[model samples]
Target: MPDLGETYACVPSTERGRGILISGDPKSDTILYTNGRSVLMLDLNNPLNVSVYGEHAYPATVARYSPNGEWIASADASGTVRIWGARNDHVLKKEFKVLSGRIDDLQWSPDGMRIVASGDGKGKSFVRAFMWDSGTNVGEFDGHSRRVLSCAFKPTRPFRIVTCGEDFLVNFYEGPPFKFKLSHRDHSNFVNCVRFSPDGSKFISVSSDKKGIVYDGKTGEKIGELSSDDGHKGSIYAVSWSPDSKQVLTVSADKSAKVWEIENSNGKLKKTLTCPGSGGLDDMLVGCLWQNDHLVTVSLGGTISIFSASDLDKAPLQLSGHMKNVTSLVVLKSNPRFILSSSYDGLIVKWIQGIGYGGKLQRKENSQIKCLAAVEEEIVTSGFDNKIWRVSLHGDQCGDANSVDVGSQPKDLSLAILSPELALVTTDSGIVMLHGTKVVSTINVGFAVTASAIAPDGSEAIIGGQDGKLHVYSVQGDSLVEELVLEKHQGAISVIRYSPDFSMFATGDVNREAIVWDRVSREVKLKNMLYHTARINCLAWSPSSTMVATGSLDTCVIIYEIDKPASSRITIKGAHLGGVYGLAFTDDSTVVSSGEDACIRVWRLTPQ
Candidate 1:
């Protein structure tokens, strides 16, 4: 059986013209962000090390750590707030239904006793303050005419709460049973973010009009504005104060993050860190955080840019990966270090274990890649654009080369074991065999082929159909000759895989059933390995062919041993926040899995 080991979490999801939130722990160097119902915590020292907390049922929007660093309060799109432990297993403490719409931001009081959440609501108020344990109302939010975008709390004595909104206003509140004190209309456009300095003596607000204002923390009195000569050229989305309260950082849509020095009740630009990109929409900087000596920002493409607080002249170190659901994964046999993965939006990223993303493969068009097949020197891929591309691999680098258009959409791709260059592609109309870069033969099977696999000897192949039938064929001169038809599955076959040693094969269907068949007898060798409750998304055989693993849409991963097929099985529930999509065995004792959560996880197999 296998146990979960390390997880490589994706970057925070971002949107245009909106503020993205990232919170840092008060006691440690970890920062938190939300993506697809999961809150990810990444260590500042080692960006590859990550932790995922996935108890939220709806899409998570914002999360914040308590002042004591003992608890975390996270909210979702359904306006549900959940408080959980910060250590051990991260157990849930309480759950509350706060509003009717999306929660944009949340903050904890200086004493870690109460929490305030603000966002878009229906007929009810968009802001609410309640006790941490009992969910009792502690304060009211009453000054915004539209959606509240951000919120903050005073860090010193005489508690105060501040909120900014699309109404172009910043509201101030005071007390335990807090009441609205005043509303400051300083910006001519929507206010995106508000934050109080660490010393609780000053606060700052940034808006879409390319303006930032400093105010008196206690009396809500207007102080001074940031220097406009060197200010942001586009809308500012987020602001963060340094730990010492002498400096602040702001990220804007102009693809830059600037550091400002606060002196004499005014702010002046100290340095500017411009993100390097192609000037596309993905280059927009949406969120930022300054904790300890590290400054982190996230772009709309989900890349995390990290900068040093003492020096902003050098280029920032970037962390990049897939931002959407992963659909296909392939591990090269020649070198196991290079891993290639494709997402739903046709983006492909190559990753090296422990070192992070290496580079990306350029797609010819906007079409999802269905499957990938690897050889010794090149990799083959089939896409929804009805074309096959060959990517040449040299040492650790790979790039796209020649491509040929198939007649129909390709569903699956497989390569011959003896002759790796011989590839077979299953399509809606038939099967197409390609030798090198040209289509050698095309066979119209007259059925919708869903999946296919080739034998290691390059002598036989099996094609699965949507009608729950398997057609066996013999390879003869780049053509498939039909032999027999087998009917055991009740639903469409989604995946078919053969063991590395080629002793047996496995088939999984949409009805959540998997069967292992003996190659010689062509009969069911194991049928009781059916514990998944939803569609089986992927399956993998260990390198030694001792065990098989299956990933499902039910958010579970199950491992079945070949010797004790019926009794010895390990079920890992909630393996991913969303459904699992791809699985690949790195070695006999290790496997890598990816899913709709946009994260890649590695598991270690141990003998039980």
Candidate 2:
């Protein structure tokens, strides 16, 4: 599938993309963040077992845990609110479309019965309050002329709600059917972050104009500013309250996260946490959340850092990964120790077992990669930029990449590993032959061949056409000679895979059907394996040549053992939170997969 529209638009790091959103699960040492289009649930205690929640159709902007700790409310750029069980398998219990534009922030009431979703809603309400279960509008958020950037509910009884918006005003509301109380306009510019104290006696709001003001949580009366002197030199993006409500934490573009003692009318700086990074104000802090004494901070690069009282100067632990949807995945046959993955942002990450998150593939423009073929020495890639890149593989460095013009952009590539010499490229118009980065020849099969595969010995070339016909051709010299046509599929063929042994092959179609063919006998249908309920996206062969793994749009990964074809099929339904788009086997015991969920997972098939 192509990159989704308008979801991943690029803007300045300070104004666009995902902000450093971190929500702490009151139940434990967990922190939630938006990993591209999905949410990542990270446990500070374990750190390695990162569980992901990936059901959103659009980019998720903010997520918050209900005070009761039993539910989570998340909002997307498309103004959709989803309330699902936090500990009960995350099944959606309620969904609401409260606004017309993007939702920038979400918060739940202390009773966990009410939720307030705030966003641009350019043409409609800037914010709204509703019943959590019934989606009934409980109150209106008035007095904001622009987008409401953030909202919070007072934690204690006399129920109160506070919202900060781009209008440089903070609106306070007073219950089940909340009413607008008043507006606190101390800030001179766009207000970004606002939060209520744990005790509900006080609240704080920060603005891009460097103002941090606290107010009486109950009456919406302005108490005093955080620092009476000037304000933050840079924009204050987020803030949090300590468990005891005595200290307030804030992160800002000034490249620091600090703690302030909450005095009666004013605040004093207690400690400053150091964030280590370089490049374009690399340490520019964006978002923060307090997990007990532990402070979690998010950087502009999507790196999460943990800081505590004992070691307030440093972040002892951090986790990093792709910040966009993974578009393609491939493993080098010559060196299977590392796996390479490409995302919608044109970022290519190299993942190793011991080390994590290797840097992106070095490209001048970093266009969206269309197809990738990897060998031990180099990785060949083609993308929408209409250029082919030959990258020298050296662990995660990606050494040196040479970009060459490929007249027409290629859609897919087939690496003939069995022969280890030929690489076939498929474009909309025809197919091209590449002999180690150099285009040697072209074959005009003419009918829009969408998928292609090379025979094990590199002697036969198979192409799947839009007409649902599999065209078999002999690879002689440079051009192809059509030998036969197999038509058993009723829809366009999506993927075709040649078995390692070259005895048989498999082809899957858009109609959710997969078929096994005999190469030696040239039979169109050797076996009909029909179990998936959605379109088969990609297929891979096991190292043993007996098992074929098929990834589909239905989110299932099925392994077909040719011995029994139908009965020996093992299905891993919902193998991925979203549809699987790519599959590859690193060895006989391990198969790696990545899909729309923006996650790469490994399924082990070794002995128990």
Best by TM-score: 1
What C-alpha lDDT values do all the predictions have?
0.86, 0.77
Clashing pairs in 2: none
| Tens digits of per-residue lDDT for model 2, 1-608 | 11111111111122342244568786777777675567666676665556666678887777888877777788888899887777767988888897899888888888888888888887679999998889999887778889898999898989999998889999999866888889978889889889998889999998887678999988889988787453467788889988889888888888777888889858888887766665455467788888786787877766566788556765446555555556677777656757788766677777664444444556555677877777677777788887777778665566777776667878778877765457888888889887767778877887988899888678988999889999999999887899999988988999988987788899998888888888889774336777888889988888678778888999888777676746567777676656888788777667777777667777767432
lDDT, model 1, position 320: 78
Query: All candidates' TM-scores?
Result: 0.95, 0.86
- Worst lDDT run of 10 residues, candidate 1, spans 358-367
On lDDT, the candidate that comes out on top is: 1
lDDT of 2 at 76: 84
Error of 1 at 306 (Å): 1.6
